[model samples]
Target: MEVRRRDPCQSVQNFSSSSAPYHTIFVFLIPLLVGVIEINNVQNRSKSLIETHLMSMCLFLLAILIYAFAYFAAMKSELQVFKAIEMISGSLCSVSLVSIILPRPYGHFSFIIWAFVLLLVAYKESFHMKIWQFWNRFGGNNQQLLPTKCVVGCPAYP
Candidate 1:
């Protein structure tokens, strides 16, 4: 297989039982939330809300990147799979941003789109169980159907 890392995880502890959500949020999400709050604070102070919001959005993108990087480092995941997932998710998200939930970045080009995709991948990995994990657990592919090469009574084809 053309891959770099192993499956999801040997144990669920890898995702959920880190015992320190505070640390995770502190190191990653808090700065992001704070930057947003700062933009609000700026708006409250009668400064340019648009400019602050833009800057806050940029900061949020940075925070997402930071969190994705941290998740990659901590999770011992395959970079190849992560890259593929990020690319596909980014494309799909852009489509949704364009077609349905049109966000600002969809209207305008922004790295925020990619950063959102990275966040999505990171958040998904936090679930611990993977597609392969579920499939294997459920014995999903036990039966196989083969096409018959012969219509009536060809021994070799049958």
Candidate 2:
């Protein structure tokens, strides 16, 4: 009698591919549910927008990371990349939740900055680009583009 041994990697690949659809559905449904709950509970409509935006951004990033991870797993390559994506997604989700809970940080400016940093980190990791390269591309390498004076002048500035 011959016993066949199933390869663990093969099982994981199968599971990841097979579960992709469910993951997609779960990702899409989460924002809708959270938005409804937040809308009802939040007294200030303006503040709710910031919380919803951060949550949606985190979910969007997670969806992209999961899609990329599943694609690579199916191809049987980039296991290390999968791990990196997993870590970033976990951290991004945690930060987003924390920002929501502490909603008054610098009048939500800090949350926006935090979300931007998470995005920048994810972009840097995925594409192996330096932070300066990204800023130069989008920010045009202008020293005065952000204008520290305005940030410092804001009432919320500490």
Candidate 3:
């Protein structure tokens, strides 16, 4: 009688390839459906600015939770890239959420400013450029792209 053992690397490769499709649907499609439902609910309701901001923050938290779950559940080495993207997304969400503490005008303006910063970061990452290089290419001088202190310094509404 002869005994044989399966190759460990082969088993891992097979598992990852087989599970990729299921992970794709779980990590991508489910969150997309959640987003659609959230948008629909928001549109159908008459919420105040604070309520809307809270809802937005909740959504971002939900997304981060989903991605975190996916990151842990994923077996493929390639799926690790989600971690970096997830962190960036969280930072962008936090930036917008910070505006909720400020007065109405400043809060709204801060949201716009942070959204632009998010765009800049996305552009820089997509083009594989350093942040300073991105600023240089886009004609920004000395990296003072926007007055971010306004968000921190603005007084809260009474």
Candidate 4:
């Protein structure tokens, strides 16, 4: 029989309920709240049950994928995950902005989108300090994550 050795750099470890970070509550609450709101909006605004169900399923899948990615990244303690999360959050913000700015009759979806986008932004920004520290500690200061020469003097979001 072979005994497995644990990696010293492993970031995730099993912990008792009491030992877990309280901040993880946001992980559960944000998804649950957004799901309920998305379902309610789809039900109220969609023209038919089929459309509502379809949209809800799509939203559910997207939300699940996003949450899964975030959870895994957090567990694995990967700093690169933030870039993907930021891209998705920015896209969601753009969608919400469009929904708010456009003169359309998408009242229900508008609020739902806005809420989800805000939640995502808040969640990501909550770790801004940690992310910055990680980058600096890992020798990422001199390396550029994105090309910025296209726009002179302007800071790139990526």
Candidate 4 per-residue lDDT over residues 88-121, each given as its tens digit: 5434433433343334577347657767765775
Model 1 stretches with alpha carbons more than 4 Å out:
1-9, 16-24, 27-50, 53-57, 77-158
Give a tens-digit lDDT track for model 3, residues 23-91. 433455445545654665675567754465675566557756755654554444456456444544444
Query: Candidate 2 residues 5-124, lDDT tens each?
Result: 655445444444332333344455546545754765577666654456665455656755665565456446545555445444544444444445454554256457766876776666
Cα lDDT of model 1 by residue, 1-158, tens digit: 68764322333334432222323334554445445555546646765434535544454455456545545544455444543443343333333223222344553444456557557756897543464355435543322332223344555333
TM-score of 2: 0.33
Candidate number with the higher lDDT (1 or 2): 2
What 10-residue stretch in candidate 2 is worst by lDDT?
Answer: 143-152
TM-score, prediction 3? 0.36
Give all candidate RMSDs, comma-separated.
Answer: 15.8, 20.0, 19.4, 15.1
Better of 1 and 4 by lDDT: 4
**Total clashing residue pairs per candidate?**
0, 0, 0, 0
lDDT score, candidate 4, position 144: 55
